[model samples]
Target: MADSTNQSTVVAFIHTYRPDGRLDSYMSELVDAFVRCGIRLHLVITNHIVPNLDSTALKKHISEQRLIEYINDVDPEFIFTTNRGGITKGIMEKTHAPILTWMVDHTPFFHHGGGPEDLFCEKDHCIISSLRHVKVFESTYPVLKGRVHYLPFATKVEDFKTSRNVVQDVDISFVGTYFHSGILENLYNYYADSPETIQGLLRLAGKIQSDPDTDILPLIEAYGIRKVLEDFNYNHIYLKWLFVNYISLNQRIKVLDAVSDLGLRLYGTDNWLHVGAYSLNLLGCFQFQKKIDTRQKLVELYQRSRIGLNISHHQAGGGLPYRIFDLLASNALLVTNARKDSDLFHLFGEDVQVPMYKNEQDLRKIVIYYLENEKERRELVQYCNRLVDRGFSFEDRVRSFFEIAGCRLKETGHGQLVKVDPDSFIRGLVRYLYRCGGNKPYSSQEKAAPAGGDRIKKIYHRYATGKQRLFIARQVVPLIPNGIIDMLRKQ
Candidate 1:
């Protein structure tokens, strides 16, 4: 490892894949931020700057050998990735530069069966969107203790800038997909015959929404479904993904149904037209606009909409959605569901009380209140925009990333790091929110112990009985030759 002080301010930014290629906008924002900080960027991406190709396609274009050679040639000060990208230990071993991965989604998926150890070196660091993820990642992968940092999604104000003169024609806007059918749906259907099992799944989903940062295994065990999941060969991380998806689908349906009467202009896939409550919601005040193709179009929509609505993906845990910043940047007042933790109050003061709702009636009331009072709404938007300007931009994030990597910028321009006293800030934020009788901060370290109910005991016995047969086969099968085992299976 060479001294970061002696290293040149060059970075190889790895642009990973998103099916919709929405993340390319984020990559561009980071590149612009890095350039402003006097750091040269080598955009390591496929043809369109959005590496949306599958693994086979990616391998056909970029071979491991070529990637290694490219890294050796660039010899960048450090490497940055939004997700893991194609960077592997083989590539990491060939360069002195460290790796920095910003986990934009659920952290467990990254550390599932094959964890971050496969990609990150000892000095390599990662940034997670949720603080709950940060604590869990550190506790799970102890090697990367101080290497983990919490940085929620941020926007490049310049990218989202729009003309204030544009009329706010759209009353409300929502940009997301409808999870009509997927793994979560498949799991639900598989247990359709067992109402108790379905109830257990729904119960797990509800619990996850309430406390998303907690690991899912304990929750499953607590709900008396560990044996059922084991029967299907589903691991904890995979279950976590399924449960989060379930919560997201159900919650989106509920919220959209409540606000659908408010003339919501939804910009997403066609799936929204057929989903549960959305099918009925579409009949009243909902316009099914085509999915957005470009970043400019999405920003324009936000700028033209009086209220930009957000439903945080359950995967984000306590982190504010990236939409929050983008909508505010485009001068749209945001109305969102209440987040799990006090991150909302932590960023914007406890007094301003960023427009958030607890239930369907509450959502309708808040949206209508803001819509009727344009003066108050605009004032709130301006305050949040000022807060974003003071800090919380991608430029600040880029600087923080380098500072965490122990690299100093060669030249400073408009870029500045936001100085924050974590202890003081959290203390004040929590105290004020508590006084206001609002949602307080939740620590991921809090234990969520598994329940030992009679149902769970029955499941355990059944699981043990089923395992006894496999236990006997394992001892005897290995002693036989491979040819005999294959012949027996054929018979």
Candidate 2:
């Protein structure tokens, strides 16, 4: 760990080649936090991501040799990268400073040839976004037990703090890519080439989707497909990636179909035409806009939207998404799909902080109800904003990260410790809930409620009443005799 008394510089390895801007956003917030803590940052840009970024701290390195020379010249106390891929093993072996890797991917399968264990040394530390990845590392490679940590996704709240001058022009909006081009076709061709293997894979996927609560690893083993994945003989990782995309794409289409009557706008790539031949025609029912590449435009869209939708890829394995935090920070009413083992119910009330649905019908009902009930929607927006503001800020996340990694900060006469507050206590309760309940609660009462009893009760009552009406409309009405219900409906 870096000493608090010593002045230190940290080198950050970044790849900005991708146009998604996710890495750019993360690096910007992290750099800001490090600067605030009095730590100097030297950015090492790789892969020719950007020809030039207007910053004196940035240095572009096109090869591993150059990167190593730069690191040696800087002699920084700590080295940071977003993932293992950002820094090569050769570079890691040459550097004596501690390398802190914050990984956002599902698993380090890309490092399969070198073995995931080779990425870390005694001086290295890893921070993963998914808890599942943490467990996999600890269990698969015991050497990384004490060094691995779990940190959820967060956003810079200040960046999203916008004036309420914009009108809520969009009733609901979804911003993501629709995978249809090369990867999808390749996956289909692979499956067609291997009928038996694909059949087994589909069977396993079907079982996992049917009961998401089941441990997929055990099921994969039982299906005897574990060896195929482990062999790495074929494109198993790519296959899994495509599978996740397929699941997410299907879910997004279902959501669009369910709420086609509403003003649902889609902002993403043009690949959505592969969903169906008539997908282009379906755009008539809802607005279809091209992808918004910049963060400013995205924040503007969120600010102008009444509701923001989040649909996680099935491979997330109950991990809370970055979009959830972004939506909360934007003060947009969030209606998302409920994860089978999510800690969201603990951090925020089931329906108060954010409304989550279990199925397509439930999602439609919740969206309609929230849209019609402006007061409830506004309250949810306020509650989520307050909760996110209290603890889920980018600064808070970075501070917690330093503490977890045992890196100390210098005393600038403002000696403040980042500790858990009342809001943090609510967030901490999520870990407890996951441990005790195995993230499976039979009923709403079984889930942990927040501090104020009266407020919770009032929120629950309002949510239950509206849900009951939706239930009667969808469930009860279908069961009633058609003649009598039709006559009653006519009256």
Candidate 3:
């Protein structure tokens, strides 16, 4: 449980850049919500950015020693970060505050090189994006017992609005980046060296692609691939990398090939060209974008397309990608491959809110059905939008954080306490009414001057009335453009 008496300050360590110089939009919504909740934020920015840390905040430092010094200076009650690499023994020893790690990606991707012993610390409390991942960690690492929690990705519903200029230029669309070259090269080398192993892997990949819900580990053991790999000293990490890459890339390519006859637009990095010789033609249909405008472009794509596709990596194990929230938030019809043990069907009823497919054939059939039947698609979009509006906003997520931290808000004369549960429909309805018309939660006027000032208050009122704010809060700096802060600081 959190120390309710001293829940005022928190220090966050995050990365601000990727190798490609693209800005990560992950922390904007959380930071905005924290400020609104009357918590002061102290940011520690690290410079070494990787895919796992892509969604971190913008600040640049390469030294861990400087980070320790800064955290000690702040003396915050809680420490927060998203990156697994950012947490180390040295940093853990330096701070007494509980370290909260909110993992946004799959466990295998971050825990590949290190053993379970090196991956977790005693002071860590983990909040994962998928329930499947929580199971994976608890079963794989003994140290993670009783410290893991699951919280899915949510949208800033107030920030994502239906665009006026709705043009269905593309019948279907996919927005994501391809894998790194080094990973692909490693896969290619392994495939060339081991023919039988490669054949078994290809079959396994097919099984997963045909049905993502398939339990792959049992299949690996049955094929004797696990034993063979162990004999060759390949280790579990190498096997994980091979399995994820082969399964994910093959499935993506197969989906694209199945949907090629339809009007499809691919928006992401150019690594799709290396998938195969015929991939050049596929790459021809690719669309690129300025790094800063990626989020805006995705919303536009969702609004303009009749169908949006979300492909979760095989390692996701029934966890949803960020794209699912974005598509629903934009009020677009989504067709995604089904995952094993996914909570999506439970959250949104089977074939009622959004359609899930078993294989590429199923995906194509569903996409065509929705495209031919415009009325059904529109209704489904409206249904999903209402669902998101009710309980999946960033504000709701912040409230969940408060619950997880055991921090109780002080009651005052004007404030009303409301309970919200993301999984329950009734609680979601109650939360929606409370947010839309009831007394404003998270108001700190009695404590200190409110964060974001009157601007945020006015925006909150507009949100309640179903009016779009002039600027979305999930942008890199929430209404302020990038580089402006640097200029102001220099002055």
Candidate 4:
């Protein structure tokens, strides 16, 4: 944030690539809320995607320096940044405005986990010092202990408030990411792990994965076949067979496959190719909009949606999302797995508790009822809309920030004497390499899937996930021989 001759506070945001995609539904409301508080929000962004291509065309919507100049030109009071990389945040930290950082996903530790060799920390989740989960801003970037709070992402109330009740087109639509290859096997494993539930849930899972008769869970093979038919386009290279086989080695292949057969239109895009089955077997459902400035369009989507979907990968620390509030705010019903059950829903809602589905079986069984039960759906949406109106807007979050930041600054505390060095980097490195490599057990996908999507979604081909193929090699051999040899010699 820059010093503004103008009195309003300026808010700045950073993105991985171009400026437009970075602003999910939560941003505008956040800025509006800050402006309500008398601070003018100004945004600064890096127009680059890859570090090298971090140039002008990549930022066609807005230029990098121009963005900075705009912020400097207005010169506001507060500055906040969405981390694109260490470098992006580092620059913002240099500015006069207090820089607040938000982690959208358990992203810091993504892609690189579950591999034998360790990569850089920035490539994975970085825990500066667990302030005991307390909101403290006083450590090395001690200012963060003061400026930062474990502020989860933002949510808008539009979808839940204004969307007209419409029928959900597909029976079971698993929107986030899914593993396509071993998905079937993983599903079996989950049931096998709990054979008792197999008989009871099997029928429901089958119905959910596929609606019995009409199509293949075949919503795509039937209604949306044209959407899938377009898969031959250059956009779908990631959903191919070889790529699935590649990433599945170190990551989740079986899970993707199982989600495939459920037969609904699986949706994905974004840096979808960076990880998971974006390209792999996630074939037909891939919809790429040739990069457009789509903020207004997305806000409109929440209004049109009957049910907005948000699911987190198992390792993703609970599946809460900014869009959850956005969907609800738009008056759309949200069908999501619980993140931190107590905090997530309640934090976002006041009187109405948002509905949560436990497993694929649990979710499918209830979908029909929610659809058929329109009165109940309308009631839920209305109740949730009112709840956020009172408790969970970005305005609420920013006000909460001042209170938390203020409390910490006033605290007087004695610094602890070091009884010992924090875990040594060398030992910590060895342990993470071992555990991330394979020591830490991979969570099973079949167990990950709901009972049965006989609907036959997409059998996303085994995708390479082009990152390091650690997840793949692990499946082939419990250990990567070369990497294992290196570890033992070090030991």
Best candidate (score: TM-score): 1
Give candidate 4 regions above 4 Å deviation: 1-6, 11-13, 16-25, 28-38, 48-76, 84-97, 107-147, 158-266, 270-296, 313-316, 339-342, 345-352, 398-491
Candidate-wise lDDT, in order: 0.62, 0.59, 0.59, 0.39
Query: What lDDT, from 0 to 1, does candidate 3 have?
Result: 0.59
TM-score of each model, in listed order: 0.71, 0.70, 0.69, 0.48
TM-score winner, 2 or 4: 2
TM-score of 3: 0.69
- Taking the tens digit of each residue's C-alpha lDDT, what string does model 4 give over 328-378? 665457676643433454355544467776655655545556767878976
Candidate 3 per-residue lDDT, tens place, 1-491, comes to 23233346666655443455433554555666666665666554433322244222111212234445556666665677764645555567777777777766553223223454556667777787777677666666567788888888887676566473577767888876565536535654766777877677667767756654455668787765785555545545445555575667766877877787787787666666565565655666666443324456657667878888988776676778778887887756878887547768656656544688898899889988998999998888877777677777665766666566555533222221121111121112112222333233333224432344434444433342232322332221243433542332221
Residue-level error in angstroms, candidate 3, position 138: 0.9
Q: Write candidate 1's Cα lDDT for 1-491 as tens digits.
A: 32234324554544433454334555666666777776656565432321242221222112344455555666666777655554555555676777787776653233112443453568679888776678787875677888899886788676545466688988888877675447777877887898878888888877777876666667777777786667776556557766777778778878877778787877666666666344566545434555564567777888889898888887775677778888767778988788557467666666655788888889999999999999999898887677677577777887788787887766644432221111121222122222223223222233432332222322322332243423433342334444543432221
Worst 10 residues of 2 by lDDT: 419-428
| TM-score head-to-head 2 vs 3, winner | 2
Compared with the true structure, the alpha-carbon lDDT of candidate 2 equals: 0.59
Better-scoring candidate (lDDT), 1 or 3? 1
Give residue 419's lDDT in candidate 3 (0 to 100).
Answer: 16
Show the colliding residue pairs in model 1.
none
lDDT per residue (tens digit) for residues 1-491 in model 2: 33233444667765552354344545556666766766656664432322232121111212334456666666766777665544656566887777777766553423212444465667777886666667765665576778888777877677666555678888988776675446545644666767766677777667646643344556566666665655544334344555566666666777777776677777766666555554653465433445566667778888888899988766666677777887887757988887746657546556544688888899889998989998989888877777677677666765665676566755243222221111111112122222232342123335554434333333323332233423333342244455543333221
